[model samples]
Target: MIQVENLHHRFLEIEYLRIGEGHTAIIGPNGSGKTTFLKLCAGIELPERGTVTISGKEPRAVNTGWVGEVPDNNLVFRTVADEVASALRFGRVRADEIKPAACAVLSEMGISHLSSRATHTLSGGEKVLVACAAALALPPEILILDETDTHLDRKAAENLETMIQRRPAPCVLQCTQDMDTASRADRVIYFEHGHPRYIGTPEETFSHLYNTEMYPSLWRIAGCI
Candidate 1:
Protein backbone atom coordinates (compact mmCIF):
# COMPACT_ATOMS: atom_id res chain seq x y z
CA MET A 1 0.00 0.00 0.00
CA ILE A 2 1.09 3.57 -0.71
CA GLN A 3 -0.02 6.20 1.74
CA VAL A 4 0.32 9.95 1.92
CA GLU A 5 -0.81 12.07 4.85
CA ASN A 6 -0.55 15.79 5.21
CA LEU A 7 1.68 15.92 2.16
CA HIS A 8 2.67 19.34 0.96
CA HIS A 9 5.04 20.16 -1.85
CA ARG A 10 5.45 23.39 -3.72
CA PHE A 11 2.01 24.74 -4.58
CA LEU A 12 0.24 21.47 -3.88
CA GLU A 13 -1.23 20.06 -0.75
CA ILE A 14 -2.72 16.62 -0.31
CA GLU A 15 -4.05 15.91 3.13
CA TYR A 16 -4.61 12.20 2.87
CA LEU A 17 -4.35 9.62 0.14
CA ARG A 18 -3.98 5.87 -0.10
CA ILE A 19 -3.22 3.76 -3.09
CA GLY A 20 -3.47 0.00 -3.28
CA GLU A 21 -1.52 -2.33 -5.49
CA GLY A 22 -2.37 -1.92 -9.15
CA HIS A 23 -1.78 0.27 -12.19
CA THR A 24 -2.81 3.89 -11.57
CA ALA A 25 -2.92 6.66 -14.15
CA ILE A 26 -2.54 10.27 -13.06
CA ILE A 27 -3.99 12.91 -15.34
CA GLY A 28 -4.11 16.67 -15.20
CA PRO A 29 -3.23 19.84 -17.04
CA ASN A 30 0.35 21.04 -17.02
CA GLY A 31 1.70 22.15 -13.63
CA SER A 32 -1.13 20.46 -11.76
CA GLY A 33 1.26 18.64 -9.47
CA LYS A 34 0.88 15.37 -11.36
CA THR A 35 4.60 14.98 -11.96
CA THR A 36 5.45 16.22 -8.50
CA PHE A 37 3.13 13.66 -6.94
CA LEU A 38 4.74 10.80 -8.84
CA LYS A 39 8.21 12.06 -8.04
CA LEU A 40 7.35 12.17 -4.36
CA CYS A 41 6.06 8.64 -4.58
CA ALA A 42 9.23 7.51 -6.34
CA GLY A 43 11.36 9.14 -3.66
CA ILE A 44 12.80 11.52 -6.22
CA GLU A 45 11.55 14.41 -4.08
CA LEU A 46 11.01 14.53 -0.37
CA PRO A 47 7.92 16.23 1.02
CA GLU A 48 8.29 19.11 3.42
CA ARG A 49 5.28 18.57 5.68
CA GLY A 50 3.72 15.13 5.56
CA THR A 51 4.95 11.66 4.85
CA VAL A 52 4.90 9.50 1.72
CA THR A 53 5.30 5.81 2.27
CA ILE A 54 5.27 2.70 0.14
CA SER A 55 4.56 -0.54 1.96
CA GLY A 56 5.19 1.07 5.31
CA LYS A 57 8.63 2.43 4.42
CA GLU A 58 9.79 5.69 2.91
CA PRO A 59 9.74 5.57 -0.90
CA ARG A 60 13.53 5.86 -1.04
CA ALA A 61 13.85 2.88 1.27
CA VAL A 62 11.91 0.64 -1.07
CA ASN A 63 13.06 -1.06 -4.24
CA THR A 64 11.61 1.31 -6.81
CA GLY A 65 12.31 2.12 -10.48
CA TRP A 66 11.39 5.27 -12.36
CA VAL A 67 11.50 6.49 -15.97
CA GLY A 68 10.79 10.15 -16.47
CA GLU A 69 9.93 12.40 -19.42
CA VAL A 70 13.56 12.54 -20.48
CA PRO A 71 14.69 9.07 -21.51
CA ASP A 72 18.32 10.01 -22.04
CA ASN A 73 18.51 11.17 -18.43
CA ASN A 74 17.97 7.59 -17.34
CA LEU A 75 20.66 6.12 -19.57
CA VAL A 76 23.97 5.75 -17.79
CA PHE A 77 25.78 3.19 -19.93
CA ARG A 78 27.15 3.67 -23.42
CA THR A 79 25.51 0.59 -24.94
CA VAL A 80 22.04 -0.98 -24.76
CA ALA A 81 23.22 -4.22 -23.16
CA ASP A 82 25.37 -2.39 -20.66
CA GLU A 83 22.60 0.04 -19.74
CA VAL A 84 20.07 -2.70 -19.11
CA ALA A 85 22.56 -4.64 -17.01
CA SER A 86 23.53 -1.66 -14.90
CA ALA A 87 20.65 -1.99 -12.48
CA LEU A 88 21.11 -5.67 -11.81
CA ARG A 89 24.81 -5.13 -11.32
CA PHE A 90 24.10 -2.42 -8.77
CA GLY A 91 21.78 -4.82 -6.98
CA ARG A 92 24.78 -7.17 -6.80
CA VAL A 93 23.46 -9.89 -9.08
CA ARG A 94 26.11 -12.40 -10.15
CA ALA A 95 28.41 -11.02 -12.85
CA ASP A 96 27.96 -14.15 -14.92
CA GLU A 97 24.22 -13.66 -14.98
CA ILE A 98 24.22 -10.03 -16.09
CA LYS A 99 24.70 -10.56 -19.84
CA PRO A 100 21.97 -13.14 -20.27
CA ALA A 101 19.69 -11.19 -17.97
CA ALA A 102 20.12 -7.98 -19.93
CA CYS A 103 19.70 -9.81 -23.24
CA ALA A 104 16.56 -11.48 -22.01
CA VAL A 105 14.91 -8.19 -21.05
CA LEU A 106 15.93 -6.49 -24.30
CA SER A 107 14.59 -9.40 -26.30
CA GLU A 108 11.37 -9.35 -24.35
CA MET A 109 10.95 -5.67 -25.13
CA GLY A 110 11.46 -6.45 -28.86
CA ILE A 111 14.68 -4.43 -29.00
CA SER A 112 17.13 -7.30 -29.08
CA HIS A 113 18.47 -6.03 -32.41
CA LEU A 114 19.67 -2.86 -30.76
CA SER A 115 21.61 -4.54 -27.96
CA SER A 116 25.01 -3.77 -29.46
CA ARG A 117 24.15 -0.26 -30.63
CA ALA A 118 25.52 2.73 -28.80
CA THR A 119 22.95 4.22 -26.43
CA HIS A 120 23.47 7.74 -27.78
CA THR A 121 22.66 6.48 -31.28
CA LEU A 122 19.14 5.30 -30.45
CA SER A 123 16.10 7.29 -31.56
CA GLY A 124 13.78 8.92 -29.05
CA GLY A 125 11.40 5.97 -29.00
CA GLU A 126 14.21 3.43 -28.79
CA LYS A 127 15.83 5.31 -25.95
CA VAL A 128 12.62 5.23 -23.95
CA LEU A 129 12.25 1.50 -24.51
CA VAL A 130 15.85 0.89 -23.51
CA ALA A 131 15.46 3.02 -20.41
CA CYS A 132 12.35 1.08 -19.44
CA ALA A 133 14.23 -2.16 -19.98
CA ALA A 134 17.00 -0.93 -17.71
CA ALA A 135 14.48 -0.10 -14.98
CA LEU A 136 12.92 -3.56 -15.26
CA ALA A 137 16.32 -5.12 -14.71
CA LEU A 138 16.02 -3.92 -11.15
CA PRO A 139 12.70 -5.80 -10.99
CA PRO A 140 11.41 -3.15 -8.67
CA GLU A 141 8.40 -3.57 -6.41
CA ILE A 142 7.04 -0.29 -7.72
CA LEU A 143 7.51 1.46 -11.07
CA ILE A 144 6.83 5.10 -11.91
CA LEU A 145 6.78 6.84 -15.26
CA ASP A 146 6.29 10.51 -16.11
CA GLU A 147 4.93 11.37 -19.56
CA THR A 148 7.11 8.78 -21.25
CA ASP A 149 4.62 8.34 -24.09
CA THR A 150 5.49 11.78 -25.43
CA HIS A 151 8.71 10.34 -26.81
CA LEU A 152 7.21 7.16 -28.24
CA ASP A 153 5.56 6.58 -31.58
CA ARG A 154 2.27 4.68 -31.69
CA LYS A 155 3.86 1.27 -32.13
CA ALA A 156 6.48 1.94 -29.49
CA ALA A 157 3.84 3.20 -27.09
CA GLU A 158 1.77 0.10 -27.65
CA ASN A 159 4.75 -2.14 -27.02
CA LEU A 160 5.68 -0.39 -23.81
CA GLU A 161 2.06 -0.34 -22.65
CA THR A 162 1.81 -4.08 -23.18
CA MET A 163 4.93 -4.67 -21.10
CA ILE A 164 3.62 -2.46 -18.32
CA GLN A 165 0.40 -4.47 -18.25
CA ARG A 166 2.25 -7.77 -18.05
CA ARG A 167 4.90 -6.76 -15.51
CA PRO A 168 4.37 -8.12 -12.01
CA ALA A 169 5.27 -4.98 -10.16
CA PRO A 170 2.81 -4.49 -7.29
CA CYS A 171 2.49 -0.80 -7.98
CA VAL A 172 2.63 0.98 -11.32
CA LEU A 173 2.13 4.72 -11.34
CA GLN A 174 2.30 6.99 -14.36
CA CYS A 175 1.71 10.67 -14.99
CA THR A 176 0.28 11.29 -18.44
CA GLN A 177 -1.99 13.64 -20.34
CA ASP A 178 -3.03 10.91 -22.80
CA MET A 179 -6.61 9.85 -22.30
CA ASP A 180 -6.13 6.64 -24.24
CA THR A 181 -3.30 5.65 -21.99
CA ALA A 182 -5.15 6.77 -18.89
CA SER A 183 -8.19 4.70 -19.86
CA ARG A 184 -6.16 1.49 -19.78
CA ALA A 185 -5.21 1.86 -16.16
CA ASP A 186 -7.13 0.10 -13.38
CA ARG A 187 -7.58 3.40 -11.59
CA VAL A 188 -7.37 7.07 -12.46
CA ILE A 189 -6.41 10.09 -10.42
CA TYR A 190 -7.37 13.45 -11.82
CA PHE A 191 -5.53 16.45 -10.50
CA GLU A 192 -5.93 20.21 -10.67
CA HIS A 193 -3.63 22.69 -9.02
CA GLY A 194 -1.82 19.96 -7.10
CA HIS A 195 -4.99 18.49 -5.59
CA PRO A 196 -6.78 15.37 -6.76
CA ARG A 197 -10.19 16.36 -8.05
CA TYR A 198 -11.31 12.85 -8.74
CA ILE A 199 -10.17 9.28 -8.00
CA GLY A 200 -11.95 6.29 -9.45
CA THR A 201 -12.02 3.85 -12.34
CA PRO A 202 -11.20 5.27 -15.76
CA GLU A 203 -14.78 5.09 -16.94
CA GLU A 204 -16.11 6.77 -13.86
CA THR A 205 -13.55 9.54 -13.91
CA PHE A 206 -14.05 10.25 -17.61
CA SER A 207 -17.81 10.22 -17.25
CA HIS A 208 -17.57 12.88 -14.60
CA LEU A 209 -15.52 15.06 -16.91
CA TYR A 210 -17.54 14.32 -20.04
CA ASN A 211 -19.40 17.62 -20.03
CA THR A 212 -16.37 19.79 -19.42
CA GLU A 213 -13.81 21.04 -21.89
CA MET A 214 -11.23 19.96 -19.38
CA TYR A 215 -10.80 16.82 -21.47
CA PRO A 216 -11.87 17.44 -25.05
CA SER A 217 -9.56 14.78 -26.44
CA LEU A 218 -10.51 12.30 -23.76
CA TRP A 219 -14.17 12.32 -24.77
CA ARG A 220 -13.23 11.03 -28.19
CA ILE A 221 -10.84 8.43 -26.83
CA ALA A 222 -13.40 7.17 -24.33
CA GLY A 223 -16.31 7.42 -26.77
CA CYS A 224 -18.10 9.63 -24.29
CA ILE A 225 -20.65 12.23 -25.21
Candidate 2:
Protein backbone atom coordinates (compact mmCIF):
# COMPACT_ATOMS: atom_id res chain seq x y z
CA MET A 1 0.00 0.00 0.00
CA ILE A 2 1.05 3.61 -0.69
CA GLN A 3 0.00 6.34 1.69
CA VAL A 4 0.12 10.13 1.35
CA GLU A 5 -0.71 12.77 3.93
CA ASN A 6 -0.45 16.51 3.67
CA LEU A 7 1.54 16.18 0.44
CA HIS A 8 2.70 19.61 -0.72
CA HIS A 9 5.31 20.19 -3.37
CA ARG A 10 5.40 23.05 -5.80
CA PHE A 11 1.81 23.19 -7.11
CA LEU A 12 0.60 19.85 -5.71
CA GLU A 13 -1.28 19.30 -2.47
CA ILE A 14 -3.14 16.33 -1.06
CA GLU A 15 -4.56 16.18 2.43
CA TYR A 16 -4.62 12.41 2.42
CA LEU A 17 -4.68 9.53 -0.09
CA ARG A 18 -4.17 5.79 -0.01
CA ILE A 19 -3.34 3.60 -3.00
CA GLY A 20 -3.45 -0.17 -2.71
CA GLU A 21 -1.71 -2.92 -4.62
CA GLY A 22 -2.63 -3.05 -8.33
CA HIS A 23 -2.36 -1.00 -11.52
CA THR A 24 -3.67 2.50 -10.99
CA ALA A 25 -4.10 4.95 -13.90
CA ILE A 26 -3.87 8.68 -13.26
CA ILE A 27 -5.63 11.00 -15.73
CA GLY A 28 -6.08 14.72 -15.91
CA PRO A 29 -5.40 17.82 -17.98
CA ASN A 30 -1.89 19.17 -18.39
CA GLY A 31 -0.29 20.82 -15.32
CA SER A 32 -2.76 19.09 -13.02
CA GLY A 33 0.08 17.59 -10.91
CA LYS A 34 -0.15 14.07 -12.37
CA THR A 35 3.56 13.81 -13.07
CA THR A 36 4.42 15.54 -9.82
CA PHE A 37 2.49 12.93 -7.88
CA LEU A 38 4.28 10.12 -9.69
CA LYS A 39 7.65 11.77 -9.08
CA LEU A 40 6.87 11.91 -5.38
CA CYS A 41 5.90 8.26 -5.41
CA ALA A 42 9.09 7.34 -7.25
CA GLY A 43 11.16 9.21 -4.67
CA ILE A 44 12.67 11.41 -7.39
CA GLU A 45 11.50 14.50 -5.54
CA LEU A 46 10.88 15.01 -1.85
CA PRO A 47 7.63 16.58 -0.73
CA GLU A 48 8.19 19.89 0.96
CA ARG A 49 5.72 18.80 3.63
CA GLY A 50 3.97 15.66 4.91
CA THR A 51 4.88 12.10 4.08
CA VAL A 52 4.68 9.49 1.30
CA THR A 53 5.29 5.85 2.06
CA ILE A 54 4.98 2.52 0.30
CA SER A 55 4.33 -0.71 2.20
CA GLY A 56 5.07 1.10 5.49
CA LYS A 57 8.46 2.42 4.34
CA GLU A 58 9.46 5.79 2.97
CA PRO A 59 9.39 5.74 -0.86
CA ARG A 60 13.13 6.31 -1.07
CA ALA A 61 13.70 3.17 0.99
CA VAL A 62 11.87 1.00 -1.57
CA ASN A 63 13.23 -0.08 -4.93
CA THR A 64 11.45 1.76 -7.74
CA GLY A 65 11.39 1.26 -11.52
CA TRP A 66 10.53 4.31 -13.54
CA VAL A 67 9.97 4.92 -17.26
CA GLY A 68 9.29 8.53 -18.12
CA GLU A 69 7.59 10.10 -21.18
CA VAL A 70 10.92 10.60 -22.87
CA PRO A 71 12.64 7.28 -23.54
CA ASP A 72 16.06 8.88 -23.77
CA ASN A 73 15.74 10.28 -20.27
CA ASN A 74 15.33 6.83 -18.73
CA LEU A 75 18.36 5.48 -20.60
CA VAL A 76 21.93 6.30 -19.66
CA PHE A 77 24.30 3.64 -20.99
CA ARG A 78 25.64 3.74 -24.53
CA THR A 79 24.78 0.15 -25.45
CA VAL A 80 21.61 -1.91 -25.18
CA ALA A 81 22.87 -4.73 -22.95
CA ASP A 82 24.65 -2.38 -20.57
CA GLU A 83 21.56 -0.22 -20.31
CA VAL A 84 19.43 -3.18 -19.26
CA ALA A 85 22.05 -4.27 -16.75
CA SER A 86 22.51 -0.79 -15.28
CA ALA A 87 19.79 -1.17 -12.67
CA LEU A 88 21.17 -4.49 -11.44
CA ARG A 89 24.66 -3.01 -11.23
CA PHE A 90 23.38 -0.06 -9.19
CA GLY A 91 21.53 -2.47 -6.89
CA ARG A 92 24.79 -4.41 -6.38
CA VAL A 93 23.46 -7.72 -7.81
CA ARG A 94 26.93 -9.52 -8.05
CA ALA A 95 29.28 -8.95 -10.96
CA ASP A 96 28.93 -12.39 -12.57
CA GLU A 97 25.13 -12.39 -12.40
CA ILE A 98 24.52 -9.08 -14.19
CA LYS A 99 24.96 -10.23 -17.80
CA PRO A 100 22.77 -13.30 -17.40
CA ALA A 101 20.08 -11.31 -15.62
CA ALA A 102 20.04 -8.60 -18.29
CA CYS A 103 19.92 -11.22 -21.01
CA ALA A 104 16.99 -12.95 -19.33
CA VAL A 105 14.94 -9.75 -19.13
CA LEU A 106 15.70 -8.80 -22.74
CA SER A 107 14.56 -12.24 -23.82
CA GLU A 108 11.42 -11.87 -21.75
CA MET A 109 10.75 -8.54 -23.47
CA GLY A 110 11.36 -10.17 -26.90
CA ILE A 111 14.11 -7.66 -27.66
CA SER A 112 17.16 -9.86 -27.33
CA HIS A 113 17.91 -9.22 -30.99
CA LEU A 114 18.75 -5.62 -30.10
CA SER A 115 21.20 -6.62 -27.40
CA SER A 116 24.44 -5.55 -29.14
CA ARG A 117 23.11 -2.42 -30.82
CA ALA A 118 24.10 1.11 -29.84
CA THR A 119 21.41 2.82 -27.80
CA HIS A 120 21.48 6.08 -29.81
CA THR A 121 20.94 4.22 -33.09
CA LEU A 122 17.60 2.73 -32.08
CA SER A 123 14.27 4.25 -33.02
CA GLY A 124 12.07 5.99 -30.45
CA GLY A 125 9.82 2.97 -29.91
CA GLU A 126 12.80 0.68 -29.56
CA LYS A 127 14.33 3.03 -27.01
CA VAL A 128 11.14 2.99 -24.97
CA LEU A 129 11.11 -0.80 -24.96
CA VAL A 130 14.74 -0.83 -23.94
CA ALA A 131 13.95 1.54 -21.08
CA CYS A 132 11.08 -0.70 -20.05
CA ALA A 133 13.41 -3.69 -20.09
CA ALA A 134 15.90 -1.89 -17.87
CA ALA A 135 13.23 -0.98 -15.35
CA LEU A 136 11.77 -4.50 -15.22
CA ALA A 137 15.22 -6.07 -14.97
CA LEU A 138 15.28 -4.74 -11.41
CA PRO A 139 11.74 -6.11 -10.95
CA PRO A 140 11.09 -3.23 -8.58
CA GLU A 141 8.48 -3.11 -5.84
CA ILE A 142 6.99 0.08 -7.29
CA LEU A 143 6.72 0.72 -11.04
CA ILE A 144 5.98 4.21 -12.24
CA LEU A 145 5.21 5.08 -15.87
CA ASP A 146 4.98 8.77 -16.58
CA GLU A 147 3.20 9.00 -19.95
CA THR A 148 5.47 6.26 -21.27
CA ASP A 149 2.95 5.19 -23.90
CA THR A 150 3.33 8.56 -25.61
CA HIS A 151 6.52 7.21 -27.14
CA LEU A 152 5.00 3.91 -28.30
CA ASP A 153 2.90 2.88 -31.30
CA ARG A 154 -0.25 0.81 -30.93
CA LYS A 155 1.41 -2.61 -31.02
CA ALA A 156 4.21 -1.52 -28.72
CA ALA A 157 1.71 -0.05 -26.27
CA GLU A 158 -0.18 -3.33 -26.24
CA ASN A 159 3.02 -5.24 -25.64
CA LEU A 160 3.98 -2.97 -22.75
CA GLU A 161 0.49 -3.30 -21.28
CA THR A 162 0.78 -7.09 -21.40
CA MET A 163 4.08 -6.88 -19.51
CA ILE A 164 2.54 -4.55 -16.91
CA GLN A 165 -0.51 -6.76 -16.28
CA ARG A 166 1.71 -9.69 -15.36
CA ARG A 167 2.36 -7.99 -11.97
CA PRO A 168 5.90 -6.81 -12.45
CA ALA A 169 5.31 -4.72 -9.35
CA PRO A 170 2.87 -4.82 -6.45
CA CYS A 171 1.84 -1.23 -7.21
CA VAL A 172 2.00 0.28 -10.71
CA LEU A 173 1.23 3.91 -11.31
CA GLN A 174 0.80 5.23 -14.86
CA CYS A 175 -0.11 8.77 -15.74
CA THR A 176 -1.62 8.75 -19.23
CA GLN A 177 -3.93 10.76 -21.44
CA ASP A 178 -5.16 7.65 -23.26
CA MET A 179 -8.61 7.12 -21.87
CA ASP A 180 -8.81 3.61 -23.28
CA THR A 181 -5.66 2.70 -21.42
CA ALA A 182 -6.82 4.41 -18.23
CA SER A 183 -10.17 2.62 -18.49
CA ARG A 184 -8.39 -0.73 -18.18
CA ALA A 185 -6.63 0.06 -14.92
CA ASP A 186 -7.76 -1.71 -11.70
CA ARG A 187 -8.32 1.77 -10.28
CA VAL A 188 -8.43 5.33 -11.59
CA ILE A 189 -7.35 8.68 -10.18
CA TYR A 190 -8.67 11.80 -11.86
CA PHE A 191 -6.74 14.94 -11.04
CA GLU A 192 -7.62 18.55 -11.72
CA HIS A 193 -5.91 21.78 -10.76
CA GLY A 194 -3.34 19.86 -8.72
CA HIS A 195 -5.80 17.79 -6.75
CA PRO A 196 -7.30 14.31 -7.14
CA ARG A 197 -10.98 15.01 -7.70
CA TYR A 198 -11.98 11.39 -8.12
CA ILE A 199 -10.48 8.09 -7.00
CA GLY A 200 -12.07 4.66 -7.43
CA THR A 201 -12.49 1.76 -9.81
CA PRO A 202 -12.67 2.59 -13.52
CA GLU A 203 -16.44 2.26 -13.61
CA GLU A 204 -16.89 4.46 -10.58
CA THR A 205 -14.35 7.09 -11.66
CA PHE A 206 -15.58 7.28 -15.22
CA SER A 207 -19.08 7.75 -13.93
CA HIS A 208 -17.91 11.16 -12.75
CA LEU A 209 -16.21 11.92 -16.10
CA TYR A 210 -18.78 10.62 -18.59
CA ASN A 211 -19.59 14.07 -19.98
CA THR A 212 -15.95 15.01 -20.38
CA GLU A 213 -13.38 14.04 -23.03
CA MET A 214 -11.74 11.95 -20.35
CA TYR A 215 -14.42 9.27 -20.80
CA PRO A 216 -13.03 6.28 -22.65
CA SER A 217 -14.26 5.87 -26.22
CA LEU A 218 -14.62 2.12 -25.73
CA TRP A 219 -16.97 2.73 -22.83
CA ARG A 220 -19.08 5.03 -24.99
CA ILE A 221 -19.26 2.44 -27.78
CA ALA A 222 -20.45 -0.09 -25.25
CA GLY A 223 -23.20 2.38 -24.18
CA CYS A 224 -21.94 2.43 -20.64
CA ILE A 225 -23.14 5.97 -20.02
Flag clash pairs in model 2.
Answer: none
Pairs in clash, predicted candidate 1: none
Residues 1-225, candidate 1: write the lDDT tens digits: 899999878988999999899989998888899988988999989998899999999999998889999877878899988899899898899999999888888877889999999999999889999999888876889999899989988888888888876665899998876777888888999999989989988878877778665554755775665
Model 1 error, position 123 (Å):
1.3
Relative to the unseen true structure, what is the C-alpha lDDT of residue 40 in candidate 1, on a scale of 0 to 100? 93
Q: Residues 88-192, candidate 2, lDDT per residue (tens digit)?
A: 999899999999999988887778999999999999889989999899887799999999898888888998888776536999999998999999899999999
Per model, state how many residue pairs clash.
0, 0
lDDT of all the models against the reference? 0.87, 0.91
TM-score of candidate 1 against the unseen true structure: 0.94
TM-score of each: 0.94, 0.96
Candidate 2 accuracy as TM-score: 0.96
Over 4 Å off, model 1: 213-225
